[model samples]
Target: MQALFILSVWTSLVALGCLAPFVLALAYVWVDLFRPHDVAPALGQLFPFSLTTAVLTLGAYVLVDRRDPPRLGLLTALLIIWAGWITLTTTWALYPTAAWAKWDWAFKTILFSTLLPFFFRSRIQIEAALLVILCCIASNVVCFAIKSVLASGGYGRPLGLIQINAGWGGEGSTLGTYAFACLPLVAFLQRHSIVAPSRGWLRWVYFAAPVIAVIGAFGTFARAALVACVVWAALLWWRSRHKFMVAIMLVAGAAAVVPLMGDAWKARISTSFAPRQDESANTRLLVWEWTIGLANQYPAGAGFNGYLGNRFVTQDEWGEDNVQEGRAFHSIYFEVLGEHGWVGLAIFLATFAVFFLNMRSVRRAARARPELEWIGDLARALSHGVLIFMAGAAFVGIAFYPLHYYLLALAVSTSAALHRATLSSADRAPQESLADLAVGHNAARLPAWRQRAGQTKASI
Candidate 1:
């Protein structure tokens, strides 16, 4: 039910905004321009029957509104620097125009990353954005369950009676990654709830979300996610021996279920379940070996987004030992190494390294500082989940693809907000009502944020 409450509030607002088209689009223009994170006037809790809000948002993001900028970080700075080199290299490459085109395409992600911080200025913005994301995921689960229930004549099939829509990723690996991202948010929120818990239905949603998400991962049938969970357990054990012992017993019980898996399950699991026995794994190894030779040819390596270029589409052997008959190496790790080379891969991995160090440091600090235990836990889970996702995702997804992009952006937003919160207790401003702020957090010539915090009666 906790997931329900959080999901409801966020979705209800989104639904409301969607009801009115033109008017809200105008309002969002004002919202994004005056304050990127500001909400348009509310239409009660009812979802109106219009498609205006989303249309307006897309319009705003594209033609009208501009997002705020991000601060400097060693890893992030390197990303921008790499982007420049890629663009420059593309200009002189065999297919200069294609190079520039892809380079420009990649910039959308950079643009997305760079501007999020400026608009999410206040703590409320951070909290609301996160709530919106969690709610969206929860809402999807509820919808999927409803669809399954209706389809199954009430109880649904063991495989879930829900039919997959054309775009439903339903991949076990996809769901696993999504769950990994979401659980940290859920756990963090639960640990810090101002109105702790009493018996409530919403608590059911909270408990159920993690379960459904994990189960859905099995539905998606990506063995990588399952492998990730297993490895994750081992890491948790290494990090905390006591937790490891308890988890070991639980994992053993789960292992017993292997016999229950259907043939479809066995077929998918066979790939990673026994990599040496799998033909696909063997092929990937061949592809990876050839790709390594390509990376060695260019010391700085190919620029980001350089793989599968005009020539790659034609298999032009972009300096590799041999070009395979296949498209990409398929694996994310190889994809990054193949495209970005040693230099690009290093910059990319460096970001994960910082994330690892930050999480480890926060976990240590959390242990010593009881006062910050909740926050420290949130930070730890957020960082840990992200790190694991990237490591797993690198093999599963081309690093920094759409799925990775959104996840990383979420991390950057969370990390930046947490850091800001620590430095400026002034952010209690979010606790205030909108009427109190009178303007958005970005409104120029404002009084100190701490003073703004004094105006609102709201908490949590």
Candidate 2:
């Protein structure tokens, strides 16, 4: 009891530490997804801890100490606009209540994402942010691994687990998406460690973290996530300066995981090719077909939870007996289209396009400058993660997922910082050169004048 009391006291102190807000943000992301109430009921009960910390941090940022103005870019502007549009759509939505609920969630996500850029100013802070995310995912991996072990009696899951819980009553696919997004950050940390000798500890995490993440993704038996992993791995290999080494690592990793993938797992993934046989796949197709019909009929859109109301209406009018009930928009593109209309979808796509283009440019800029290479590597990883999400979105609904916007903010902020650094360096260069020239001129005159003085004295 004494030990427990002491431990509780220590925990409280840690929570109240100077860096508590950042830590709380990570904890919020984890608990929001994992819902580890059984593991730590105290923390679990404090479910709103993350949001509370975020609000507190924002207050601190504004009032506690005067800080520089936040670095806002195209992505930030677009995100705010996107949030406003989402709110506007709620008014015209088929179900205002449902739309309002979604709007509330989106508002929180956008607010948190917008606040992220302000927190990350230095490389260490950025890396720390990356670490926070990695740790959150790691918690999920550990939880899932334990569940798999218990379910399989330590032999391991033969077909992988189905619908691993990821807090807020979410499913394995959601966890898989989270893992997929984070993989690139893991790679970035690893690469950063190699480039910067100071972060030597990350090298170990680099090797271990990816394997765990892969396991976590596979455990979910999420085919889309697995596909994303393949794409990511390929991209990583292509970007690697050491192709041979990366290839060897990939081969070795595959060899290790192949034995663990039993026939059931193999068969499940193979269904990706023969999606018709899968009930889920068949339903998705029908949903998509229904979506197209609705899109044509209502070009303006249904507005927030519009699919539910529109689906019933469409069926009665179009009167298709074979059509399934209107389901959640499985695809992000389709979701935005259904809720916000073609105009919303266009803006959504445009936002992503602009954000990605900026990242690519940042990558090129970082690569060109040796000092900013870390930022470049980060850009590359973020862009790859975004691509994975883009493809993964077709399989699942995550249009308003916080991670997506957070990553965009990350990319934009990192790019802005790099440019600012470059400009600062450029500004200092001419001043430095002028100083050097003046010093040289003074030295030359001193020697000549000294010689003249000596000659004059000798002649006298």
Weakest 10 consecutive residues of candidate 2 by summed lDDT: 153-162
* N/CA/C clash count, model 2: 2
lDDT of each: 0.50, 0.67
After aligning candidate 2 to the native by TM-score, how far in Å is the CA of 243 from where it should be? 3.6
* Model 2, span 1-460: residue lDDT tens: 5335434633553365355444444444443333344345565465544455455566655654335444677788888888777777778778888888888877778767776777666577567667655665566565555555455211123222222233312355656667777888877776674433336575566667666667766766667667767777888799889999999999898888756866766777777898766656666676677777766766766777777853322232244444445578777888888888777787788888988888888887778789888888888888888888787667777788766776787776687678778888999999999998986676677777786776698799
Cα shift from native, residue 21, model 1 (Å): 18
* Residue-level error in angstroms, candidate 1, position 52: 11
Give the per-residue lDDT digits (tens) of candidate 1, residues 238-345: 557588576776577477645544576677677775655554555556667767876887655565444443122122225333333534455666766766667667
Candidate 2 pairs with clashing backbones:
33-166, 33-167
- The TM-score between candidate 1 and the true structure equals 0.63
The candidate that wins on lDDT is 2
TM-score of each: 0.63, 0.82
lDDT of 1 at 288: 70
